[model samples]
Target chain A: MLQIENVYKTFNPGTINEKKALRGINLTLNPGDFVTVIGGNGAGKSTLLNMITGVYSVDSGKIIIDGVDVTKMPDYKRAKYFGRVFQDPMMGTAADMQIEENLALALRRGKKPTLRPGITAKERIRFKELLSMLDLGLEDRLTSKVGLLSGGQRQAITLLMATLENPKLLMLDEHTAALDPQTAAKVLSITDKLVTSGNITTLMITHNMRDAIHYGNRLIMMNNGEIVFDVSGEEKKSLTVDGLIKKFSETSKGMLSDRTLLSD
Target chain B: MIEFIQSLPSPIAQGMIWGLMAIGVYITYKILDFADLTVDGSLGTGGAVLVVLTTQFNVNIYLALVAAFAAGCLAGFVTGILHTKFGIPAILSGILTQLALYSINLGIMSGRANTTISWRNYKLIVSSKTDELFFTILKLIVIVGAIIAVLYWFFGTEIGRSIRATGCNQNMSRANGINTDTTKIIGLVISNGIVAVSGGLLSQFSGSADVNMGRGAIVIGLAAVIIGEVVFGKLFNNFVLRLMSVVFGGIIYYIVIALVLKLGLNSNNLKLFSAAFVAVFLAIPYWKTKMAVKQPASKDKKTVSQKEVKGNAAN
Candidate 1:
């Protein structure tokens, strides 16, 4: 479970570029809650995720994960409780390291690294099995540098890494946006399977309206640093893309074009 | 030609000693992806510590070397703290540490710019004054070999892998809960420690530790790394073999310098030559990417170009 209380974040305060990224935002997620977030550009969706992950400190707020207040924690320390996938495919893995090495690092998340062997013989076998499950032929290339992998393959591997230690909260920030449509679909399916099987609490940000509606048990629409709509259960399941667009237009008063949301 | 041949042994010995320094540079430059300028001062710190301990304190030669290594580690620790804790840029942090070490090295030499230890009175490990060139060469080789072996093993460990990951992708490392700042500091410490050891060895071989001994140490180390990668990179794919290539690169660099000196070039111009050599080699990959972009035929080529640009931006 995760809780955000009265979170406020402002970038470049008192300057020409001053902008309030988040303003008094509050949200909570129950155990095993799968939430999809949708918003136009600059909706503070990514900022909200960043706040939770401690990538950016909230100006005035508290972030509690699993009953521990981590608002003051550094990004790396906060990472112990969360599995995160970035929008950039290249951001989630060390390119020069081997496939198995990346996985081994992921397995040691929230644990101290010691002088032990980086990847043991037994761990290698387990990693090969895990890679084979992705069906990307990465099992055969355990020692191959991660930079050589395709974007889709890297995202899939990143997804696996996020769940390797079974995180308290899984955060996906447009993780599949960089891939082609077919590749994106494949990675999204992998994401669905992993999140469901592990019963992980997830907060996913997506720009595509169809995907926003297609996945997750609950959906929230954000605009101008605030959540404008929250729908769940049967209401979320029965919602259509057109209806969501109509609701967004009415709520934001046509400040953003529907073309941005309708492109997908 | 006979003169060049006769002088080959000395250059080879000096090269082997500097090869150790080059290996240290390789850790920060290639592995940690940091252009740490701390080596220029730390190398002198090593020699100063060794000379002070051996000549003034009358410590054992081996103990002097150990003291020198520890001194180098301390120097690197200062730089690491400056960069990580104080939020200074990596290059500036190194420069600041290097500037501080200059005075420290002088103080270690009892307010002198140079210190000499006589081989006749002191039990020396390796020296150019000794007539046994073969033995000196053999001893230096053994030391370099041991260092390379230790480093090869260290880089394969879990902590070492994390350091490598920290260099390659700080974002990924942090997401995986790695304290990247700690890893960077550790890397600088290890690198500077090795560099100091090399400096200590050089001071012993040359019979004195001069204040300006490490004036362009970073350049020579980089030259060795770049030259090694250019010549033997394709042939040596294994980690151990790659380290060896760096040693060989140092030897080759010294041999070339010796040849040029024998051909009547001034020894003072060696630094200029070294700087030019490293500049050219470092530009090769960038030039290759530019050429690839000009071809504009393959999607993979574009990707490589973009990746190179990204890498440049990151650096």
Candidate 2:
């Protein structure tokens, strides 16, 4: 479970470009809760994720992850508790490393990293089994450099690596936006399967409204640095893309915009 | 040819001395993804510190070397802090540190532009053998052995992998809970610390420390790193090979330069030669890829190749 209480983040305070990214925002997720977050550009969705991951300090607030207060922790310290998949697939993994090597690194998170005789047989076997689960045939290419993988394949590997240890929280920030539609769809299916099977507590930020409804047990909408709509259970079950767009316009004081609705 | 063969051991020793600095450069340049130029200044600064502490202050010679390492670490820390905390570019941060050390080094040398070892100063190699070359070779073996062993041990620890991971992908490193900024600082500190120690050794080897002795050191270090990487990259993926390759690169560089000098090449053109060597080593892969691309269009399979040759050369 994770809790964000009275969180505030302001960038470049007192400067000409000053922007209050998060304004007293509060949200909480119970264990195994898969929450999809939807917002337009600059709606403070990514900023909220960055704050949780400790990329930027909150102006004022506390972030509690699985009973551990992580508001003041540095990014690296917070990483052990959460797995993240970035928008750009390349950003999620080290390109110069082999497929197995990247997995080894992920496996060693929060532990002392050492270089011995390279990858041991036991580690290789475990890595192969994990890679096999992706069903991407990556098991056969353990020595292949990650740079040689396609964006979709790399993201799949990244997703597996992120979830290999089953961290307290899994954060996906438009993880498939860069892929072709078919590849994105495949990755999303993999994402759906992984999260549901592990029952991992996940916060997925997506630009697609349909995807917001398609995946996750709950959904939240944001506008102007605050959560304007938080729907779940039966309320979320009956929600449609049209109904959500209409609500955005009625409660958020703005049209949903063609791109926002079309993106769904 | 006999005389050339006789002079080979000295070059080997010089190579080992330069190898220490080159490995330091490799840490920052290859691993940390930083363009740190602090080696140019910190090397001389470290040498000056070692010389003054040992000769003037009458400090223990071994302790002076440790002091030199600490000074280098401090210099690298300054550069790292400037870049990470103040948002300065890595290159500019290094330049700033290098510029600041010029005066510090001079101050260490008692305002003299250079300092020569006094008669009573402890020598690093104290054999009574009349052959300077034999003594130098003996010193080289000891120093190189010490360097390789220490580096191998240091980089084998958990912290070393973290430093390497930080270099490979800083963002991922942070996401994985490695404080990339701290790692960057540590990597540079370790790197420059070794560089400074090498300078300390070099001062003893030359029996003098000049304020400007560290000029073009970055280029030379880079030359050694790239050449070692290119030549011996295929031998092994272990960190040990990486270190050995750096030493070999330095040796090759010195030998080539010596040969050039023997062929009536001007010493002043050393920088140009160094630059050219780095460019060629760096360009080897691109040229190979270009050649591969230009291959007859019959196959038209322009997929990204999984060739080690392609990747290593590109790097």
Candidate 3:
């Protein structure tokens, strides 16, 4: 459902800060493929996702989503095809807007906003029902400003927003890294339930090794702007954190520091 | 005190007119989260267009007001294009447009710095010289009320909500598939249009449109917005009521100015006073945040700091 061909991205070329973020990377995903990506810092994992979402243009590559080449598409345009959750909880929702208003905006993704009422009476009822499902008591605070919510609640709302329109691809970029462990687990479980029920195609980037192994049908390890390992099916299911770490150290030429790769 | 009381009506009328411009500023400043400097020039553009159409082309007063509003929109459009399409910073883009409009406004008035329209010869809508103060007040109230009503409805619409979202959180807006560039441009357009209309009304009421009438307009508008929020923000949380409060803020601002003038302050120092007034109010929130940060031992300090961080991100 998504294809990346010979994608190359270099930041600050010809300068002291020059760095090749991606180099001739190519990957393709089949329908309903759930991939978990793991890497150390500066592994180009986020860059790859940013390129796919058109947040940053690839220097030389084509991104095709659902058979349409969207390499040149702007971030907002590509947004219609992808549901994205950012690393920062605050990045995913407008703080000043009400809870229902944010949901209404998500529900209208890929549709043109018009002069009609922003939040309708019927939509409010639907929103309340959806919020209740999160069990966060947000249903009672439909008109409460999103800024008043905690980090975990905001991230949860963001997850709901991402799935509201049943996007073609769901992208999670360390979405729970900022939350406490308990809150992270709750959000991750919510993520699992939504993706499983909807059969949504997803690409999740996680720093935690257990989470990397605990979720998804496939797992890929990236290092130095290249995918070093790709494991799926029974192989991915049987893999343990220790084995994965051994493999990463070997493949990455022992560049995988214990602090960087093994930290949760 | 009696002199101040007698002078109250004139400033009140003028305040209502300036309140229209303040409302326009509120859209960009508060709603769009844009520090648009376009109002300083667009206000003059409105008055110039109105004066040129009414005096030179003999257009109907209402038509002149409409033309002035359109002219202001055009000015804002230029700033929006420069900011969004050319990738200029919004403040720089507004400054560029404001500079350009100065020359355009001059040309519109046929190279004249000031133009006067006689109430005796022209069918004026509202004027300070008119003996019927009741009629003038009623007319100003109706105009401001109609504008507030329209704006209240517009902000509740889908497009309006998107614009608000763009201001509140641009990253979230884009991820939700909103064309933030388009929304921002529309906001500037709407804001400048309303500012121009207020300029038109001011020109009519004061009997003349001066080239420099818009100088420091942004400061005055900000003062009104800050003052309104400071005074009535807690009580007036509803959107429409908040807008009404802005109008009242403008009136209070003018009344304060009138009182100071009555107390024998030099008129030339009014701009300085306005600048100082806005500066103090703008600093209040910052000071509060600083105080919050200082209380590091407090349990709720973390929440306050988080809010501060969020506010920074929104900007």
Candidate 4:
């Protein structure tokens, strides 16, 4: 479970360039809840995730993971409780390291690193087994540097890495947004399978209304640094792209300048 | 011609010693993705510590080298603290540490800029004054062999792999639970430690530790790393071989310098030549990309850092 308690963040406070990024946001997720977050620009969707992940300390709030308050914890310190895939595929995996090496690092998440061989003979076999599941032929390229892989392949590997240790919460920030349409769909399918198979507590952020509608059990719409609409269960499943866009427009007073939010 | 051939042994031995410093630089520059200027100070620190310990304290020569390495590690730790704990930039932190070490090196030499240890009074590892130049060269090769072997193994370990990950992709390392700041500090410590050891050895070989002995060391170190990459990048895919290439680069650099001197180039202009040499090699890759008739596959990789920029724009 994850808890966010009335979080607020204001960037460049008291300056002429000041902008309120997050405004007293509060949310809670039960175990195995796969939540998809949709919002227009400046909705503070990524800020909310960053707060939970401790990327930036919340100005005033508490973040609890698995019943432990981690609001004051540094980003790397609380990394044990969560796995994150950034909007950039390159952000999730080291570019120059080999495929198996990256997986080995993920396999030891939350554990004190030791002087043991980074990639053991046994772990190599396990990594191959895990890689084969992606159906991307990465199992055959265990020694290949991740930089050499295609964007979609890198994103697929990053997905596997985030879920490698069955993290308490998985955060995906538009992980497939950079890929081509076909590749994005494939990665999204992989994301759906992994989240359901592991029953991971996930909070995903996306701009595409269809993906926002198609994936995850719960949907929350954010605008102006606050969650404007929250829907889940039968209500979410019954909603279509058009219906969701209609709701989004009404929440923002029908001033929809960016139509691409629903174009996909 | 005979004179030039005979003079070759001294620089060859000198090259092997400087090669150790090159490996240390490789760790910081190539592996950690940090341009550490700390070696300029730490190398002198090592030399000062070694000479003072051996000549004044009457310690064993080998033990003195260990003391020098410790001194170097302490210098590197100061730089690490400045960078990681105090929030200073990596390059500035190194410059500060290097600047401080000049006074410390003087202090270690009992307020003297140079300290000499006579080969006749105490045993030395490798000295040009002795007629055992060939054996000295052999001993240095063995030493370099052992150094690379240990480094190769260390880099393959989990903690060491994390350091490499920190260098290549800090965000990914942190997501996997690695504390990158700690890793960067560890790298600086290891790198400067080795540089100090090389300095200690060079001081023994040449008979004195000078405050300016390590001047422009980072440039030479960079020169060696670039030369190694240019000469052996394709041939050595294995980790151990890659390290050896760096040492080989050092040897080649020294030999070229010696050969040029023999061919009538002014020794005073060597520093300028070295600076120009590194600049040209650094530009070669870019030139190759521009001159290629067909663009390479490596060009297709759209740099992935743009994702962070987009993430910022979205928020």
Candidate 5:
């Protein structure tokens, strides 16, 4: 479970470009809760995730993950409690490192790095099994550097890496945003499969309104640095994309623009 | 040609000593992707520490060498702090450390510009003072081989892999819970430590450690690394062999210098020649890639093929 209590964040305060990124934001997730987050640009969806992952400092209030207070922990230190995938595929995996090596790094997340051999034979066998599940023909290429893979393949490997050790919480910040439509759909299916099977508590931020409704047991909507809508269970299942868009317009000053990048 | 052949032995010996420094350079340049200039200062710091300890304090020569490595580590540590903690740029941090080391090296030698240690008096490791060229080269070869073996093993360890990950992609490393800042400092420490060891050996080889001994040391290290990549990069993909290639590059570089000197080139222009040599080799890969990608609209396949070739190199 994860908890954010009345957290607030401001960027470059007092400057002309200063912006309030988060405002008295408070949200909590139960164990195995799959929460889909939807918001337009500057809606603070990504900012909230970053705060939980410790990428952004919580200006006020606290972040508690699984009973551990991590409000002040740095990003790398807080990594032990969570697995994260970024919007940019390149940001989630080391290109020059071998596939197995990247997996090994993820496997040891939150653990102390030691003088022992990084990838033993036993770990390699497990890595192969895990890679084979992705069905990307990456199992046989365990030793191959990740840079050779396409963006979609890299993102798949990154997803595998995040779930390698069954992290306390999984956070995805528009992880499929950079992929083509087909690849994005494929990745989304894999994500759905992983989260459902693993029963992972997740916070997934998406620009696609349909996806926000299609996936996850619970859904939250954000606008102007605050959560304005929340729904779950039967109610969340019944909500359609058009209904949600109309709801967003009623509660907020602006409309939820179409998911296309060309939209204002 | 006979004269050049006769002069080969000394340059070969010089090359082996310089080769160790090149391996250290490889750690920072090729592995960490950090162009650490700390080697420039750490080399002198190593030489100064060794010479001062051996001659003034009557410390054991081998112990003095260890001290030299620690001294180099300290210099690298300072640079790492400047870069990571103080928010200085990588190149500037190295430059600052190298500049500060000038004063530190002078202080280590008790304000003396140069200090001499005689093989005749002290039990030196390997030296030019002796006429036993074959044994000296043999000893240095073993040392170089041992260093390479050690490095190969170290890089296979968990901590070492984390360091490599940090260099390749900092975001991924941090996300995976590796302390990139700590790994970076550790890398700088190891690199400068090895460079210092070579500096100490160089001082012992020539029977003297001078304040100016490490001048343009980075360029020479880079030259050796670039030469290694240009010559043996394709031939040897294994980590251990790649390190050996760096040493061989140093030898080949020295051999070329010997030949160039024989062909009526003045020693005064040696630095210029080295600079020019490094510049050309460094540009070759960039130029080759540029040409490969500079095709017309009809040559999409050519570009893909070139990219695949480059990708294959990653393995």
Candidate 6:
């Protein structure tokens, strides 16, 4: 479970470039909750995720995860409780490291890292089994440089890496936004499988309204730094992209930009 | 040829010193993706500290060397803090550290600019005609071997992987729970420590320590790294081999310098020759990569098909 209370973040406060990225925001998620977040440009979606992940400290807020307050934690410390997949495929992995080595790192998250030989036979077997689940045949290329992987394959591997330890929370920040449509679909399916099988709590931010509707047990729409629409369970299941846009218009007239409503 | 063989000790010794500096430079420039100019000053800082500690303070020579190594690590840590904590760009942080070290190096030398270790009591150089050959080879083997071993062991550990990962991708390393800021500090500290060792050895070999001895060292080290990477890039996969290649690169670089001097060139023009050598060697890999890119894949149709098979393996 996660909680955000009265969160406020302002970038470059008091300067000419000052912008209030998050304003008096409050959110909560139960265990096993998979929440899809919909927002437009400058909607503070990424900022919200960044604050939750401790990439940026909130100006005024308290963030609690699984009963532990982590708003003041550094990125490295906060990483122990959450797995993240960035929008850029190249941003989530060391390109020069081998596939198995990358997974080894992921598997050791929140645990004491040892200086023992790179990988043991048992660890290697476990890695192969996990890689096989991606259905990308990455298990066969365990020693291959991750740099040579296609975007889709790397993101799939990254998704698997994020969930390997089944952290308290998982955050996906438009993780498939950079991939082609077909590959994105494949990765999205993998994401679904990962969340469902592990029953992990997740907060996914996306620009694609269809995907926002298609997945997750809950949906929340963010605009101007606050969550304006929160729908869940059967309410979320019956919502269509058009109906969501209508709701956005009703909640905040003329605030729903045309570009956002039509974005894939 | 006999005379050249007899004179070989000087160049070989110089090569080892340059090799150590090159490895230091490689750690920052290659491994940490940092342009660290601190080596120019810290290298001399190492020599100055050792000289002052041993000769003026009457400290033991080995203790002097350890002190010099610690001084170098301190300099590196300062640079790391400036860059990571203060958010200064790496280049500027290195420059700031380099400037600070100039005054420190001067203070260590008592503003004398240079000092000799006075071989009156110490037989540091092993210069007897009978012992020269054996001693030179012994020194080369031991110094190069020790450096290679340390680099190998350091890079094979979990901390080493985290350091390498920080170099490749700092953000991802942080996301994986590796503190990249701390890793950068440790990497640079170790890098400069080895550089100081080289300085300590140089002081012993040359029988003197000069504050100006480290001049143009950054360029020289960069030259050595680029040359080694170009020549041995395909020859090795292990990090140890890569580090050793820089030592060998130092030797090759000095040999080229010696050959140029042999062909009716003045030693005074050595800096120019060093600069030219570096420029040419640095361009070799870039040009080679360009040529490879320009060449059609059809030239190696069989290999092309094999690569396609590998691509298919991913699917």
**Candidate 1 chain B superposition, TM-score:** 0.93
Error of 5 at A60 (Å): 1.1
Q: Could you give candidate 6's per-residue lDDT for residues A98-190 as a string of tens digits?
A: 888788777767654556654567988999998998999998999898999988899998898899999889999999787767788899999
In angstroms, the error of model 5 at A113 is 0.9
Q: List the candidates ranked by TM-score, beginning with the highest.
A: 3, 1, 4, 5, 6, 2
Candidate closer to the true structure by lDDT (higher is better), 1 or 5: 1
Looking at model 2, residue B51 earns an lDDT score of: 88
Task: Note the DockQ of each predicted structure.
Answer: 0.57, 0.34, 0.57, 0.55, 0.48, 0.36
Task: Give the per-residue lDDT digits (tens) of candidate 4, residues A9-63.
Answer: 9999999999899999989999999999998888899889988988888899888
lDDT of 3 by residue, A1-264 (tens): 999999999999999999988988989988888899998899899999989988898899899999999999999988999899999999999999999999999988878999999989999998888889898888999999999999999999999999987899999998988776777889999999889889999999988889989999999999989988998999999999899999989988977674657765
Per-residue lDDT of model 2, residues A1-264, tens digit only: 899999999899999999988999999999999999988788899999999989899989899988988888878878898899999999988887778777877877776455563346798999898788888899999989899999999999989888989989999998977776667788999999999888899999987888899899999998879999999998898999889888888766865563643454
Against the true structure, candidate 5 reaches a TM-score of 0.95
lDDT of 4 by residue, B30-141 (tens): 8899999999999999999999999999999989999998999898899999999999999999999999999989988989988998788888888887487888898898
B201 Cα displacement, candidate 4 (Å):
0.5
What are the runs in model 5 whose C-alpha is more than 4 Å off?
Answer: A255-264, B296-315
**How do the residues B1-315 of candidate 3 rate in per-residue lDDT, one tens digit apiece?**
787787678889888888889999999999999999999999999998998899989999999999999999999999999999999999999999998989998999999999998787788888887485667789989988998899888888889999999999999999888999999999999999999999998998888888899999999999889889999999999888888888888999999999888789899999998999899999998998888867865767777678666543332
| Position A71, candidate 2: lDDT | 87
Reference-based TM-score of each model: 0.96, 0.85, 0.96, 0.96, 0.95, 0.91
Q: List CA RMSD, all candidates.
A: 3.5, 5.3, 3.3, 3.1, 4.0, 4.3
Look at candidate 6 and give me any clashing residue pairs.
none
Q: Mark the 10 consecutive residues where model 6 chain B has the least summed lDDT.
A: B124-133
Better of 2 and 3 by TM-score: 3
- lDDT of model 4 at residue B102? 92
What DockQ class does candidate 5 belong to? acceptable
Error of 4 at A242 (Å): 0.9
Top-scoring candidate (lDDT): 3
